[model samples]
Target: MKKKLAATAIGAAMVLSMGTGVLAGANLQEIKAYLNGSITVKYNGSPVQLQDEQGAVVLPITYDGNTYLPVRSIAKTLNVAVNYDGATNTVLLGEQAEGVALAKDFKNSSYHTKDPNLTTYGGKDYKEVYFDNAKSSRSSSFMLYPKGKYQKLVLQVAATGNDIESFYVQDSKKDIKLKTTTIAIQDGLKTIEVDIAGVEELFVHADIKEDGGMFVPLTTSYFK
Candidate 1:
């Protein structure tokens, strides 16, 4: 992945008058409830929702007749990365990769066999998610949905003791397939990178040996 430059945002501001006298031990920060105000944010034509700890709007505060909204909250709703420099009292905002967070992955009913212990199927004790074809030539698939813009579906897959002959994303029309030089893991899943751009609905399908194929899972995320 290529790195992008980060943006910076300020949270709050304080100003004092020349005539004001300050005491060395006196505190200056104060908090008060604000009402009768409106604030809205949007991203990609979609409303960016912002909420407070109590699930209420993190309203803009009026201090010294100036209104301000929490910068961190606004950045988060837009999926922007944020970092704070306490020494310099700075807030750094950068490009953060928002991935396709899996809520639920639906699997097909046609699997050759099922095993809880992945070590039996392969060699690793890692958890097994889905298998394409281990006893038959049939194709098994899993349907998934991811939002926002992405270039491909990232998968960590391994088959038997050797790499599978064919593996592809079956939900889209484009010829998306796994391209990797790493051989199949004898015990764990290997990262398989493939192009799956412009795909909102994902169908990941794979075909391994009819007699000795049980794909194991490591981790799955989106890549752009």
Candidate 2:
């Protein structure tokens, strides 16, 4: 998986900009140890240990001289909810249900879209695959060469008001199928790619019904 530090940091900044109060102070070493799996941090002032999916301590983070942790993970472990606002760069830690409301508020107030037709990959016109609620359902036809012939398959998506849950590409003759898991839509552009085996005609489907009201523009490209 890709390290989400840039996106996470942007979200954090938005939260702070919204006047969300920051924790006055925390021990850098303690936070570091906790994230590194060297130490377990228990909320409620308890002594229980927690671990990441791998049983390793999800190491604390230090970026540009500032210490940080996975806000969602830490909040959950501490029995709190985490909320982030990409537009304002702010975060809120509290109960889960309340966090949803906060997130909805941010979405409603910060939602905006710019023209996505200008995006491209490897000089290929990407707007050919773009779609929005206005067009609700559409199909994109493309060809994918064998893996050695192309370096990668790139998809650029920009959406607001809805999230892209899954995308699919299929080759009917060869029985090749590819699909993406749920991906959250942030305020700007997001790029996703996959490695291909060879050249083939592919039916590409990008699904974005999660929030129903949004539009998504998709561009497909092959890299050398």
**In candidate 1, what are the lDDT values of residues 8-110, reduced to their tens digit?**
2223432221113332334556567453145444445455555542356655556555555565555445444344444444455542244442323434455
Whole-model lDDT, model 2? 0.40
TM-score of each model, in listed order? 0.41, 0.33
Global lDDT of each candidate: 0.47, 0.40
lDDT of 2 at 168: 64
TM-score of 2: 0.33
True lDDT of residue 216, candidate 2: 30
Q: Taking the tens digit of each residue's C-alpha lDDT, what string does model 2 give over 21-116?
A: 433232124232122333334355554443443456445544444445554455445433345544544454432122111111111112222334
Candidate 1, clashing residue pairs? 7-93
Model 2: how large is the Cα RMSD against the reference? 17.3
Per-candidate alpha-carbon RMSD to the true structure:
11.4, 17.3
